[model samples]
Target: MPLGTLDRDPPPFFRQGPSALSKLAVCSALAFFLMVADARFKVMQPLRVVLATVLYPAQWLAMRPVLVFQHASQYFSSLTAAQTAQQEVLRKHSLQSQRANQVEQLSLENERLRKALGLRERLQSPSVAAQVIYDAADPYSRKVIIDKGMADKIALGSPVLDESGVLGQVTRVYPLVSEVTLITDRDHAIPVLNTRTGARGVAFGDVSLHVDAMELRFMAANADVAEGDLLTTSGVDGVYPPGLPVARIEKIERRVDAVFARIYCVPLAMVAGAGHVLVLEPTNAQIPARPAADVPAVVPRRGASR
Candidate 1:
């Protein structure tokens, strides 16, 4: 096999079918014609399907790079997304743990407060826990509905409380549902007293003008009340028992013409936003408490120098 013979043995480039440009032009013209035929009439539907079937393997081969890139990108994206979700879950768990610790501390402080006030240990009113289903239909009234109703012994005028403080009073009762009026409603009135100065007042909401705030009316202008004072039920009203938390005084103003000082309060408990609540059922008897002992007189100590 001489080199020259080998070179001449097979024509270096044997003529094949059509030239690349000619083949491309013919394919393009056929595709355009087919598209036009399909658009103009539906007669080419079966032909198009058969053509697609014949070209399926080539089409798949042409798209291999794109498919591979898509799959790889998706894998990396999924890994990053999974990491982000895991971090979010960890952060939420940490926040919940912190909240739990704070709740425990608040419970201890509340117990200490009850003991110091010489106030009878407030009997934990027996309550039926309920889940809030929905907000009141009427926008004018600040009310909510709960899952527990007459079936659970929940009745009208029963006080509802959350973990933090008092939420509202049940106004309506149904077979399996109950409606509660938040303390922030205009028509709603609650007897309240200042925890710091012992000043008594009535809390009323003006639904027509104010929604988030309540008014404490009939407070004396010279009353020793201040902002941030905790308002509690005076128990004067037969409806709500005494010493129940009502609201926290946020602002106080005295006007020359007005006879009483104006006090605004924000409800301690979020009645509208709460998910769970306790319906406190009234008890027949008062809470039991030990009588206070009299203070003994102190004698002066005898000292040698004196």
Candidate 2:
């Protein structure tokens, strides 16, 4: 009775014609031939298109199950993720709507302020919205290039700004793009004033950090400058608008040996972190036209090198 089960014959296993390795080899050879023929002979074009079209739906359908399962697992894994995603979308929409509203309000307010201050009507600086393409390729340089350029009405010396405050001015203009110099460059200096005390000073920058923080040079040792003082544009440079935020006095260092107090200032505007910027094209009234007499004329001198 026990031997009866063992006595039953095993079911016949189906035998494939070729071994798996052999079949794989044959398939690889055929694929190579097809690729060579299509690339070299320009044949199999129609066949490739036909095969792709036929298999596309099947391939997509097969992937749907895996993708659906993965998404379903993710959805169930964490409620915070779903909430975060929803919050992100809502925040984005809210910001965009707020920005739109602000644009309208600014336009109306700018018009009224311009009229009230007798500021010349800006000729509408023809501008194109541009995105910051990338940071400066040279780590030592604090500069950036924007997608917009001369082709888009961007010009040298055109002031760039963000919603918060002034960023920088365009230094170079190319056909398809433009380069901007950040206020953080070692050579780039801004005339700033202590907003609270109305004390004025020039802020100098260090190019290494690529931020607008600068040292207040030549401030007297007995100067009333202190930490937390808000620095703003004094309008002496004529490049930046008066009262525009520049930086904050973060710290002050004074010693008997040093002639001036070493003060570090942090820029109010985050130029590096901004995605979009506004280009302010100076109006005729904003910048006074230089008279021919006042403009320096070059005169050829006999002693000068040719």
lDDT of 2 at 104: 90
Worst 10 residues of 1 by lDDT: 112-121
TM-score of each: 0.53, 0.52
Q: Which 10-residue window of candidate 2 scores lowest in summed lDDT?
A: 115-124
The residue pairs in collision within model 1 are 186-205
Model 1 scores a TM of 0.53
Displacement of the residue 70 alpha carbon in candidate 2, Å: 28
List runs of model 1 lying over 4 Å from the truth.
1-123, 207-210, 283-306
lDDT of 2 by residue, 1-306 (tens): 587668455555655368899999999999999899889997988888999999999999999999999998887877778888999999999999999999997786565444323322332443344668898798877888888887887767776665555567788899998888877777777888898899999988753343556788889888998899998878776566677677888888899988898888777666667566666663333676776667677899989988
For residues 1-306, write the lDDT of model 1, one tens digit per residue.
767656545564666568899999999999999889889997698987999999999999999999999999999999999999999999999999999998997776565444323222343556677878999889878889999989888867888776556778889999999999888887888888788988677889854335678888888787788889999988776556777777888888898888888888888786556776777775323345668999999776888455
Clashing pairs in 2: none
Please, what is the whole-model Cα lDDT of each candidate in the order they appear? Answer: 0.79, 0.75
